[model samples]
Target: MHHSLSTGTPLRVQDMHKRFGQFAALDGVSLDVKGGELVCLLGPSGCGKTTLLRCIAGLERQDGGVIHIGSRDVSRLPPQARDYGILFQSYALFPNLTVEQNVAYGLTGASREEARRRVGEMLELVGLAGSEKKYPGQLSGGQQQRVAMARALAPSPSLLLLDEPMSALDARVREHLCGELRQLQKRLGITTLMVTHNQDEAMLMADRIAVMNHGKVEQYGTAQEIYSAPATPFVAEFVGQGNWLPFERGADGHARVGGLSLRLHGERAAIAHGRIFCRPEAIGVNPTVHEENLFRAQVREITFLGNRCRMSFELNELPGHALLAELAPERMPHLASPDIWVSLPPHSLQVFA
Candidate 1:
């Protein structure tokens, strides 16, 4: 279990296209997953993340494009010939088979001894060392998932494909299993591609994320990059929470919203009318004198989370338009009054055309 397999291999998809009659399920999707890296395909429902994963697994043939696993092209190959192991969303464990039997399912031609040894190694690797004779129905959801994972990894596949592997479990179990799966993948050094609609899951487990939309990848980057510098409005809105304010470019080159003129951080775009996007956490409460974009905000409501609080307030300059700011609970005592100063930092603002 402590040995290294060096089984990871680079996976590349180029201009992959798949269509269902007049509807396009995957439209010119392309992605690159490095060797030993965990990349998640994240999007809302009907965004083609699952379809992209299916094409890579050869479960669904693409209308056009090429897929490369390491140096071999697998576009025309079937699922069994793709040199990958897959764990489905439903676990897919045979109800009639014991845990050992399920784990040994992929060891088609191995001798009994070899299969037993491999099964033990896989089960131990997934922390199910002594649960061999138990049926899938006899184990908890998390344990059953581990059995499916062991089965998937029993063959030592070069690429590991996970299609929402933790979707069936509840929130707490899913969170726990996400960490376990990430550690296991890193320990084996396997190239992994996962499809998930849960943004939190993707952010927690993936080394990099590919945000898909309408059958296409909108952006691909690290969690911080995708969260901090989103490429599109869809990506910005989809990946995290934010507040959008409509602004007009003034004669002096500043963005004007209602009675306030704000100076932005980056080079100004050519668009005259657009929205300024800023995260709730980026809005500063009662900033210092040197700070820019200062305005008096009326505290409409405050929701106290465990460690942090979300304050909903409307700026005096932009009346009737409420914006949210997230701050630590310790700072709540300082803002006892209904009206307080808040700063919208220039560097935190993103302009969308």
Candidate 2:
């Protein structure tokens, strides 16, 4: 349940557990979001991502563990008292209210002039400055979402929670807006936690990603760490598609998979059999003579994705694994032939614990 944090940390979640009747929504999850960090809680639906966010926001109660904000215990604190701002899936704007009014709604005690000024600034920050006079219905989907963000950020709470912020938008809009959101967060230097099921979104937006599964954080690390060296089988499979090969590690840090031997970075890979994660792009297509760790794979299917093509292949005698490769359109010459020799470098082949 111990979580990593800066000294005298900004926020920490220690062994948090939550359940709904018989279903465990969060199980012994521990993580930390440092000050001004944009950490994304990433996982598939029903993986406890939203539930974990709710716990932090004080919207949901945990049966176990402590929630700390800036070293203070906030586990027992109520939502309003915790001072965290939350932006849900819907914009939740009042149709009758102008964008300005919606953005300034929560600043109830402030003077009308002050509220209006603050709302104007928030709108400018979210690229909706001129749209303040319009109602939510007058704006497009992206504009409404921006208004929602401005509203959530108006109070200037200590922490910000965004639940599937880009989920409601179309694919192209989602991609563009995600970059914008990341830029906004960076400019403001806000400490924020976002929940998303989109792996690409999480990888692109997060400072660090916490991968949740079965109501627990199965693996948590920087995007590269999680992708390159996944600690769990789920992480290896979920972060990106990989061809896993079963092989016994030798004392000198060498292993064999599909009859191809590899020399590893650290020498202890020979102790026992473990899974080697071979990333699609990492597998060199139609390798040259300099390459020695080559495998014979049969192309099962090939899908053209504009500039690139996704080729699914199978090794003649490997178990519990399938090889997926991505090839540039220009590099399709050699791969058009059957039974390509794929070079899987030892460095690209990640070994799991």
Candidate 3:
């Protein structure tokens, strides 16, 4: 793990609200990104992730609420007055100017000599030291993104805002740059907020992820926390691969699904009828009799997903519901029969009320 310099100034947002006519883009959105931490605003389209980022950057004014960068109240300030750097999805580089000029554009009060030095330093930091003379049109998509990042980091702003900065690149390029961007953020120790619809991208780069939906944050937690134990039904369905099956409270006080009464894990949820969710990887196929929560299932479909194979199983008692199991390629031999026994780990099941 990379260590960050503690600045003690977190990005605080309180009761933020934004609206476009009758449609509410953001409603009571609040997040506190600790200094030197990279927090990602992640969700599907129309989830207000981009709108919240724009509001934080002062490009789109919030209809209500306050945004505090460090200790400063930047809610009502113009974009230029706020001490923050922004990187857009388009990699908003100047095609008319060279890379060096573009990176130095934010150094408003710095002397010419100082600006030149800063530009050189930034270009080198982004691995484009010798390409300072290249225009945006001359560079590849990845290179243009690097230039944009360099420009954002040049001024050493108190906060950094990234709005889908790598969405336009190829998958391979995006994956490669995601690691580089995480490393850069750790090394710089700058407070950063990134808005992205890509779950893989957010999982790869964010220190903490704020899962948003319909103008609100549904859940905020570390990657493992969000993946392993989702806070809401929406988070369970959206964050990662999981099987969400409708389960009703049986007369025995256990969750009843697929005509099977199974022992509930953790405390019982408040709602009687909801979903019982668990990750595909947590379910075991054909485990020994010593294991608990065994079920009779038939393999309905098989999907080859590169490193792992996804096996969709239909419960013998509940033919309408399907449970997906992500098994490693080596486990193929263990799943030879369609009517195989499956075990749901006791600790893996979560009730979404």
Shift in Å, residue 253, candidate 1: 4.1
**In candidate 2, how many Å is residue 190 off?**
0.7
Clashing pairs in 2: 10-70, 249-269, 249-270, 250-270
User: Who wins the TM-score comparison?
Assistant: 1
Residues 1-353, candidate 3, lDDT per residue (tens digit)? Answer: 24456962589998899999999999899999998999999999999999999998899999998999888999999999989889998998888999989999989989999999999989888889988787889999999999999999898889999999999999999999999998998888888899998999999999899999999999999998899878888888888888887888876547888678777765763458888888999998987555777888999988999999999998787787788999898888877789988888768889876
lDDT by residue for model 2 (1-353), tens: 12223222256899999999999999899998888788989888899999999999889999999998876799999888887778887878899999988999888689988998899889988888788789899999999999999998898776788999888899998899999998887766678899999899999999899999999898888999989888888988888877777777654677866555677656436447777777888888787666756767687778899988888887655633567899897888777666777777777877765
Cα lDDT tens digits for candidate 1, 117-187: 99999999999999999999999999999999999999999999999999999999999999999999999
Which model, 1 or 3, shows the larger lDDT? 1
Reference-based lDDT, residue 318, model 1? 82
Q: Model 1 segments beyond 4 Å from truth? A: 1-7
lDDT ranking from best to worst? 1, 3, 2
lDDT, residue 264, model 1: 80
Residue pairs in collision within model 3:
none
10 residues in a row with least lDDT, candidate 3 = 1-10
